[model samples]
Target: MKVSTRPLWRKATLFKGVVVTLASLAALTVQASPAAADDVYGKPVGGAILVKYNELDRETGPLGCPTSIELDNPDGVGKRQEFAGGTIYWSAASNAHPVWGTIGGKWGALGYEGGKLGYPVDDERTDPDGAGKRQQFQGGTVYWHPTLSNGAHPVWGRIGELWASYGWEGGVFGYPTSDEGWEEPYQSMTQSFSSGGLTLFWSPGKNDETSWCKQECVGYSGAAGTDWFKETRVETYVGTDQVKVRAIPTRNGFNNARTDFHGAWNQVWSMAPYPKGINQVEHRSLYEQFACHAAWAEERLPGDWNTGPTWDLESWLPSIGMEKAIDPVEARKHKCNWT
Candidate 1:
């Protein structure tokens, strides 16, 4: 949901170079818009936006003739123009800088003008840590970080929203070190940030209470396992719970990675305190299915999973072979890890 923030957020935390005056922000309409989303493209636009378009390096930059007219900022006093490949934002202080590519695409997806992120405060720039590129917006930033499955993608969406609640770049998560990505089997928009990382997943496979559906939750944190070599694992969050498959590399066993798929964690937990209640049966089934999935990933990927690039399960499954279903009782003999 779109939330208004303290005026201090704009003038205080971020870069000093692009701060717009409070008086200017006060003069603009509340969430103003000059062009609708369905309007025609490549139409002529005038004023500050046109000046920025004229300055665009048409020869190399991913820009085209103005696609939308200079529109007014709904949250503040800013002007922006859309192009085929990028956008230009203008303010008295920040001038008009260009934002394009992955960052621009994400900006467009967030409703451009009407979305929660208000307006672009600055152009897209490479983050200092080199995790990836990002652009500042009124509410929060959109991050395009590198992933083991997909090279670099717009990984921050809802997780970014959760991050904002935690305190944005300053919160516990810090700036995103990796973009939120999906690992076929994982089903979460998993993203790693400066501090640590976050895993988020939504399940139509089961009811809400049993899973971390409505609330912002932190799932699992990988740690050293008993069977030796640093462990690598993936959990399938479904129904109401999750089932993890682990690769336990020991000194004796070079790449000893195995999971019975039934582990202790596979058992269904009770749903949350709610009115509608959660589906305990579906929740149990989801994790059981994950155990079979764990066996699949371990059988195929084998060895140290981290040694090479990560693959998306949704796509990788079909490429390898049709995934086989497993029964929780049969797999319990060789189940996964437990606390």
Candidate 2:
């Protein structure tokens, strides 16, 4: 046994050297392979985009699989990657957000993150109505609904703010039907919506104004006991000035009788109470009283007033010399009910 001790030592050293070599090779192979080599889709996805992709459930989720490696955004500061279902955009400020479907198409048309909309801050989400979808971006929001033939539309800037005031998709506007557009005549920015043929307009140095047509004429006979009249109402607002013209049928029960009209009808125009310092007396004598007088004068006429025709109240108010009666500045202060 003593004679063979040196041979045994050599064998032991050889075995240790082989084990170390194998260990080194194993580490090298691991280093050479992709970190995210799980590549069930055969494409390499890594970095923040990869993390988002995984969050979305990768190949099994709605995003499907990565169709392309992460690419540089035009802005150079951001990165994006395309997938079968959508694209994920990543920026240092916005982190990562997935935009897809109609909303994605609209955003792309608006120039992706390069256009006015900038980067998306949140993922695409279902609207409160549940049927529509909306996604928030740095500059604005894009909305989509299956029922809309025009696909998706964006609401942003001052007009966007006004839409938000009216309650967004859940409000009177429903969903935007068109993107922001220019109205050469008014020299204003405009956007249309799905509800009541409503459109919002914004001009330089002015608050938002809205114009909408009533789909049907509704009858109203305020507390004054005046003859019931059907009004085809169309409202147009400019700054704080609101002009509501009711085109009433002259052939109602008061055909032969006449009433003295001092101003607009005695009706509660605002659901909310008037602000402080503005009492009901001033609201009636100044705004509604004059508006009512104008309507009464219009009713006396024989042609369209008898037929329940659609007329412009703002334009008519001036023709009757009652325009001064509608003090837009005072009207803003009072919040008069021009019924």
Model 1 Cα lDDT, one tens digit per residue, 62-91: 676566677777647777777777778777
Count of backbone clashes, every candidate in sequence: 11, 10
Q: What is the lDDT of residue 239 in candidate 2?
A: 42
| TM-score of each model, paired residue for residue | 0.35, 0.62
Clashing pairs in 2: 262-289, 263-288, 263-289, 263-290, 263-292, 264-288, 264-289, 264-290, 264-291, 264-292
By lDDT, who's the top model here?
2
User: What CA root-mean-square deviation does each model show from the true structure?
Assistant: 21.1, 10.0
lDDT tens readout by residue for model 2, 185-253:
445677767765556656552333442322211111112223433433333343434444443433542
Query: Please, what is the whole-model Cα lDDT of each candidate in the order they appear?
Result: 0.47, 0.61
